[model samples]
Target: MSILLIDSYDSFTYNLRHLVENATGAHVLTIHNDSYDLPREKESLNKLVGSVDAIVIGPGPGNPDSAQDVGIIPYLFETFPKTPILGICLGFQCLCLAHGCTLGYLEHPVHGQISRITPIDRNSLFRDFDTDFDSVRYHSIYISTVTDDIIPLAYSEDQCLMAAKHAQNLHFGVQYHPESVCSEMGSKLVSNFWALVEKRETVPIRDSHLLQTEPLIKHFKTTLEYDYKYEKIPKVDILSACERFPDPLLLNSALSPGEWSIIGLPEPGRSLVVGNSREAGLTVGTWKGETKAHSDSLWSYICNHMSQRYYEPTIGDPELAKCPFVGGFIGFLSYEESIPLTVNKITSGPTPSTRLCFVERFIVSNDKHTFVVSIRPRDKEWIQQTKSQLQTCSEPRFLSSVKAKVEKPDKKSYEKSFYDCQKYLHAGDSYELCLTRQTKVHVPKTVAPWELYKCMVKNNPSPYSCYLDFGDARLLSTSPERFLSWNNQLSQMRPIKGTVKKHPQLTYARACELLKIPKEIGENLMIVDLIRHDLYQMLKEVEVTKLMSVEEYQTVYQLVSVIEGRLQDSIYTGIDLLRHSLPPGSMTGAPKKRSVEILCHLEDRIPRGLYSGVCGYWSVNNHADWSVIIRSLFNYEDDLCSTGTTRCFRCGAGGAITVLSTCEGEWDELNLKLDSVLGIFS
Candidate 1:
């Protein structure tokens, strides 16, 4: 069935659509009216009456008392007496005005407000309205006085006419919104309204809905609250809890939890889209029923659509920054997504492209009290179950200890590829080419993915590190590079190029000597320029905030640089900025486009997946922070043939190669990047 929904300039109209469609199981078509004005033509009103089964006049920005404003509501009231109509907030005021009542401005206007209402009398509209019905109120005007024909259904603390219904007709109006999450029985109230048209029994409708990911989301939220939501437990305790979870799909961040540590996932009613598809995060960009397909080709329109549906509503609010996934999405960009932009399509891996909705189960976080955290906890049952699942690796039949034999190309083959890239540099086909290869780990079957993640975090702690799960394919990332970070009008990128092998024995004087090499400094300068070029497309007033600075990690001392820029007013979306700077310049080399093409041909097509890609959060306010998906282990567990210790794992590692790059030294650079990650192999 079709419902004609007239939008009165409420930025939150479609959010109601998500609730209405889920509650009524009907399609809702919307038309935005200007200043509360609907189509006045006789033919237009006739067409609307002929087409729709019911009408929903939505909430809006202005007072309904204006003679010029809300003209259509009164017009429709007289013209279509038999049609079913429900009004909320502004529309409710219009209903009062049409029925000979005046609207009064509240002494204190409530914006983004939520309040409770009690049903004083029973009406056909509030079938399920129980004691103390929770309602969300966000309007400044109230139905001041109603004629004897208008009957009151509910009242608030201040004695406002919170709801009204026609004495002789089916017309119903609610002073408070039942569509918002803050309104406890909002979905139920909406469901009853729909049942009025269907003439069916009203069923229980949940205010929130979580798609296919509900199981993982449920386990994560429940376990997270049960374990570390309040207390600041040791990091290991959280890890033990996450490892007990039943599902293979999970996400973990090595961040310290404080206030945001207790956030639970939003329910399905909060989402416009829902899915439970299980595909790897690395190679999959969009899975069936899970998310939309926005290939590089469709990205422009996708961002445009998102800006309107997700961003426009957040323009001037003081709390504009806290809304999650306003028009945001979170997932991985496989190394292969940009292959078409770089070299020809090299179908390197069997994984498909997948990206998930940040619309449902959403979270909004900033750097302070509300930090974006990735916590992984097992099922509450814990230890005994964890023991049975210990051996997740594909090692030999006999159980063995720590030392893991690297199973990929030999040292000679890596040096050979290094020289192959050098030939391209000499030919002037590339500037700097980032070259990389994956080294597989083979060991005893007893290696738990959770234990390996804990070890990786303990040894190499990074600000943006995470354990991203995609069911069978999981990524344990400890990346140090910030490909891009957008916070409101500001944009940033931190690229690490120059590397110095760090060891306990190496003195500061000796390490300084190694780090001061001209070659390393040149590499850092080169990529910064490439990054500057990439950022210039979407940003203005671009500048380097930090020159080559040394960030000391546990095992490596690397030269890092930060580029900052003001987002261009014309650039409303940053996904294009992401596409523009993809496969990150530090990983692809200088003169990015040409360098990436050269690497694809020179290094042999190794499936990059999450490696060299990125993972982070995206907020509706056009804000984001992403880390280069590097120094990560990709574990591909075979479900059918899988027994204990039968999983295939690879740690992808690489570094920048310039014309001055030495073939012998490149492998060592790659090895140092893999240094901390190798503990997972142990």
Candidate 2:
């Protein structure tokens, strides 16, 4: 069987596609609603539609009244009246409107909220189901009245029209999202739809007519090339080397000659990976809004380099196996590198939008042991020289204090943006918008980047903390959120959404209660759905392993959720997964593309730079890990404050803005996040 899913640029469209395939054993082809809306593509779209067994109009943003929103969806109903059709959310609204029904605004718009779905009658879509079931909803409009030719199948707890079908046509519509993780009996519901599709009487297409779908088939098919090889190098105890030259001293000396990337966490869960471009390493960078060639080469290099692994095989130390990185590409991507820009152009910054170094020599440490390793055929002599320096090294005296200045965000400007986000929410432009503001910090040039990072780590240690210096740019990130991480076995993403500041009156239980509120949970749910959409693109059997759990960080309590999926190595590489799921969903709001567009305008075309991007390493051991660059400080060469001796940095901070977000509440949350990083200066 075959199904054509007409996606309306919604994040949950893939979830629906996967569900339909699982329930009906059909090959599903998904295309954007506008993919074939052009006059030139109409005939091809018709041939494509006729080739499929059924058609599904998926949910999306915007009202059905706008032709721009619904695109060719309305055309499908008129042209193919006999085709079996199932419409969801925005699609449902479009379906109802075509049959002479009207859509009205919901008094309380629900996005990422679960509601009880009560069946008006046991139709084919809800057959053998409970009287009432729960399903997630993301809509601002609902069908106000039913047409005479339409049969109402279900209603929500609040008595809104939830599901309906045409009396004589093979068309069905549902107002809620059955593809959501929180929805109940979703598979059974999809199975019931399959039954309806089979029972409908329609003229079958000839086998010769089916050949017209070749173009569509080719569009969905993905081809991957791989060539795996391994080579062995040398290894040494990192702590033994660090014993004479501790991190403060060792990193300080290393930073002067070349670019450096460090990913470290505190002891107990302690692990640190440091690599530099001192020898046999290439320092490559792509500027903001640069052509795709530069960034593409970086991603291509990671894939090729990781596939051709170089390692020391004789050192079959079990401790080495536990370490995630042995030496590979270490770098950071600026926020602009991840998403399609809605604005015309991004003003070029002093540093590149993305920077990476192919590290041939590096040091890695875990709780029990530490080691310095290298990739073979190069960096051998450099390792010997580094070891000699470590042996004779005297602990460098680090400066205790550095004069600094902070430029706080203007409150009136922030509150105005908050209101602007609300206007978009009410207008159905977005369900949740992650609004952010940047704060400026200035420190004397005498303060070393390593020392600044060391102090930041002492103040706030995170699971994905790092100190990155790429010649022109430096980043000190103490982010608790893990954006994406995957090894040979499985891939995972932990997105942090809700936040509760730690206080004398707050308890763990109290924070739990606050995080579980409908508003907070809704914010997290939107991002969760967005991430599921991202994973489904390159993975199979995606699962939300943990949902809305309170995780305690150093200074605040955060609501974090874990999503995991396995990557089929033959079909998709870790780089493919990383590249496709850019600019973490937690940082960008739901319905990613639209939300990013809105953010660009609301933030006044100022590029977020590296502040909300991701920083991590793609390892030689076929492992990749990245963190959403939040609660972090970053500096570009030309962006320094108004003095020759002072070097300035930017810290981006914000909260997710939903319909329920208060102006004052969001302002306070933004400041609370800033303090976690900016406090080190104090």
Candidate 3:
């Protein structure tokens, strides 16, 4: 069977064709009114209509009043009264006029306005309609009144007839456009219409014309209420879920309960033949920590390590060869005081009262490297499990290994030191000083080859980002820096450039202080300026909704700002704007191209994989949220086996360095950043 689609614009036809074809799996023949004359179009359409099973009039910009003299609607009804016909937007008005309904133009046609459907009667066309779902209206002229023979299937809140069906004829029309993505029940509406048409082709005419009266209003009302009340629900018991999972890395914790999970497998690639039962407990919550600097430090350390050991002239010049794989560095932040709560409860071993330190886990070259530098947990189970996992992996390296030879510090002394640090923090003697570090892993032989291809292809395609949180812990890491994410809107970018570190004792504090410096602040401000400029190009009015501010995250503190603007009516696809303004100012530094040159000249690698790229999703309403792909990894299939290593990860880190920046200090700061991930190994 085939369908006839009449549209004034090509875009409407392009979008609706997919929906119609997908629903009915039937051939679609489209006719553009503006391009074809009525006489020629009529001759062609007449022959096509007879062969097609049904006709669908698509939505488009144009006045139905202007097209009334064309007589296309009358021709269709007269030629194919027995065949089912559906009208959308302008076509709906024309259909109503053809069926003796009146149409008039409003002074202001509510374009892009959402109109709620209030069904007036039971009918197949309004099967999914009640009082809940809203259809997007994009027209100036609407059906003002209908005749007695026409059934008022749906109406807008303002009492305008949005949809109607003829009582004696197989004709239906909707004032609102359902072809656009903005139409809430568009897909369902099209599906129902096609189902009705299919039934008519098989059953008796009377049997196929039966109307449905069971109201779906209650279900829709409950759904809307639940969506509205979702935020008010209390958080679930995360600790119990974690205990059930046993792996701290895979616990589920987020704002919405039962929505997300953290899955932990052997880093890079670990072949575990376990089924869903074993994998179910291995998922956890998101991680809340800021470790960009630490990640940078780790990358620097890796470069240095490669320079000393893996560097080879034969594999192409070290300076020119792009890094083959992407890398990921994660800093899991926890409240400083919370460590003791989990540490003291260990059942099998003596609990240490040592100052809690950050952990670092690195995935380089596919293999995982975990480091535990400063704060050692007293829990034997936690420590033992971590050690066992590390040892199982080949060529594991350990730093700061206490030989169990030095006499253990007494609990009194350790507790006193802990309180001393806490006292100093509370008294404002010092800002909350958290330890940080980075770890470097050689992308194991298992998952290394797919790196180069991914880097080349994803240069700057779409703004991409992801957030997975399931109650116990949450991971809010995206390479692209998403400074502010709320209400289906997002502002993020890749921020790079660094300065040398000063005052060895005040690294963390100095890093925080430098972020506030006017020079750095101005650079960030310039990036915001560029973003605002880009936003204003697509939106009506732009606003710097958030000013530059220091946000203290788990492992590191960052300077974040926000900008917002009202989207323009003319702007259809946001991906175009995202593609045009990419490799964000934060990553490129001020005077973007110059910064890239400097980076290429200074850094030892190229194509930072998912490190500097962006990834995220866009909703059906054109509302979008995305993030920079910084602390992330790309997992690829291993060449050796079909089901071999399929996971690879990459993380990128750098800072704006002025003339005052020293190489050694930069190296130390980089290492400090890498500490958090490396600590995870220990």
Candidate 4:
């Protein structure tokens, strides 16, 4: 059987796809609603309906009454009256609106929250389920009135219309999300819907664009996780060993430029990955590392490279095999670059959109041991020199303090944007929009970038802290949020959304109290659902292991959630997952595409550079880990700026804006986030 899922640019559409596939084992195809104009041509509409036995309208943000928000959905209702159709949250409201039903605002909107619901009748969609159950709802408007032809199937505890079916047409609608991880009996609901679908003889159409065969996995026959002999790349030559872990800040600063990265700090760093470019190593783009010739988009090139070098790691030294980074590409994808090149046309920038280094020689340190090894035999000399440098490395001192020229987003301008955001929110344009601004700081030549990095970590230690020197640009990040991480079996994403600035008087209990409110919880929940959607797109099973929990950081207390999904080796690889889930949802906000579109105009259409991007490594062991580039400082040599005595540094900060947000509160949050890094200068 085949099903056509019409996506309205929502994050949860794939979760629905996963649910439907698991329920009926049907071949599901998805297309955006905007793919067709209103009144789809007679020939095109016939072809679209003939290809599938059933059609599904997925949920998304924005009002159903707006044509711009729901493209061709109303037309589909009229064009295919006989086709089996199912409508979800936004889709449910659209179905009611098409049948002369009106929507009413909820007294209190619920997003990423669960509510009790009961079936009025033994409807096919709720057959054999519990009498009363919890379903996840993410809507601000409910169907207030039902037409005489509409049969009510279920209702919420508050008497809100939850489910209905058209008496005249073979159509059904549900206000609650059956695909949500928190929803109960969701699979049964989807299976019941499929059972009611009228079975008809239809030609199996080949959707080459939407349905492709899963990629084949190349298995390696080796006992060790990394088979240097099997690949014939080189042998691991350990030149040095540090009995006691050295300060990453000092050790990283001593390395000479090529392309270098330090993934953790001495204070609170975990799963440390430290490496620099070597003449024998391989490099891509303009950054340091070994040299390689390539002409392609950055993401595709990395994806292709990782695919060829993919390996299976099993039955080795447990500690060594489990290392997150076992020598691979280390770099970032800028916010502007994360947008597909076809969509993002404005390319003016001082640095490349992506910069990565293939480190053959690097350091991998756990709590018990730190090993400096090289995969390339040619890097023996450089590895030895690196060992000598770290042994003799001394703490660097700053000659002068960094100074801020000015904050680009002054309070008046920020307030204007804040009100504008409210306008969009009140109109149901966006449930949550992450707004960001950049601050420029000036530093003298005498003060090295490494010294600044040291100061930043000393003041505010973060788990994903890193220092990157790409010759043209330098980035120092102390971000607490793990954008995404995956090993051989599973992938995880930890997104931090709510923050409470630390003060002497505030205790951990007090901070938790402040963050457990409606606004803070809503902010975190939106991102959690959005990320679940992203993971469910490719992963086989996704679960929210942690939801809306408070964690204390150096400068602030943040609310974080952990989402994990099992990896299907034959289908998508870690690189494929990275390519699909770019520009982390936490940074972009919920209803990601729409929120980003709105953010561009609000932030003056300027490239965010490296501020809201991702920084981490794609390891050779088929393991990867990345962190959102928040609480970061980036300095580059632009042609417009002077290079003699002082250089310009840029830092970006922002907060999520919702209907409950105030201009002053958002501004204070923005500053509080900025101060986490900006305080380093003082």
Which candidate ranks first by lDDT, i.e. highest? 2
Query: Candidate 1: which stretches are off by over 4 Å?
Result: 1-305, 308-328, 341-350, 357-405, 442-448, 505-510, 637-645
User: What total of clashing residue pairs does each candidate reach?
Assistant: 33, 2, 85, 4
lDDT of 3: 0.41
The candidate, 2 or 3, that scores higher on lDDT is 2
Q: TM-score of every model?
A: 0.53, 0.86, 0.33, 0.85
Q: How well is each residue in 1-682 modelled by candidate 3, as lDDT tens digits? A: 6777775442234446656776677666666544344676666555556666788876644456566323365567657877888888766777777778787665444543457877676458767565557766555566777888778888788878888887877788888766544457777777778777753232112211111122111110111110100001122232222222222332121222112222222221221111001112111112332111122222233223222321111222232122121111121211111111111121122111111111122111111122211111243444345444443443212222211111111334323433443333232122111111112233433422222222221321112223322112123232325522212133333232233333436466666677766444543454554455444333434456555665443345556666665434433234334543455545544234333433442332223323443443322122334455443333212211122222222234444332223334444555544332222221
RMSD of each candidate? 23.4, 7.1, 24.9, 6.6
Error of 2 at 352 (Å): 0.8
Candidate lDDT scores, in order, read 0.58, 0.72, 0.41, 0.71
By TM-score, highest first, what's the ranking? 2, 4, 1, 3
User: Which consecutive 10 residues in model 4 have the weakest lDDT in total?
Assistant: 229-238
lDDT, candidate 2, residue 375? 50
Off by over 4 Å in 3: 34-36, 40-43, 68-74, 128-131, 198-682
lDDT of 1: 0.58
- Rank candidates by lDDT, best first: 2, 4, 1, 3
Candidate 2, superposed: residue stretches over 4 Å from native: 199-298, 305-314, 342-351, 377-401, 640-643
Q: Supply the TM-score for candidate 3.
A: 0.33
Candidate 4: tens digits of C-alpha lDDT, residues 1-682? 7888889998788888898999978878887877765454546655767878898899987999998889878888877888889999988888999999988887666666678989987767788876789988777788888888788999998888999988888888899989877788888888898998887766666543343324333442332323321111121111122212333321121111112233322222222222222111223432222335444545555555566665553424555554556566776667766563222222224345555665545665544344454555355665566555455534444335565454446888889888898777655567788998888777777777777776786677677777776656678888887888887688989989899988899999999999998788878878888888887777778889998888877678889899988885536666666767888899887788888888888887766778888888776777777888898888766623435677778889999987778889999999998888887665
Better of 1 and 3 by lDDT: 1
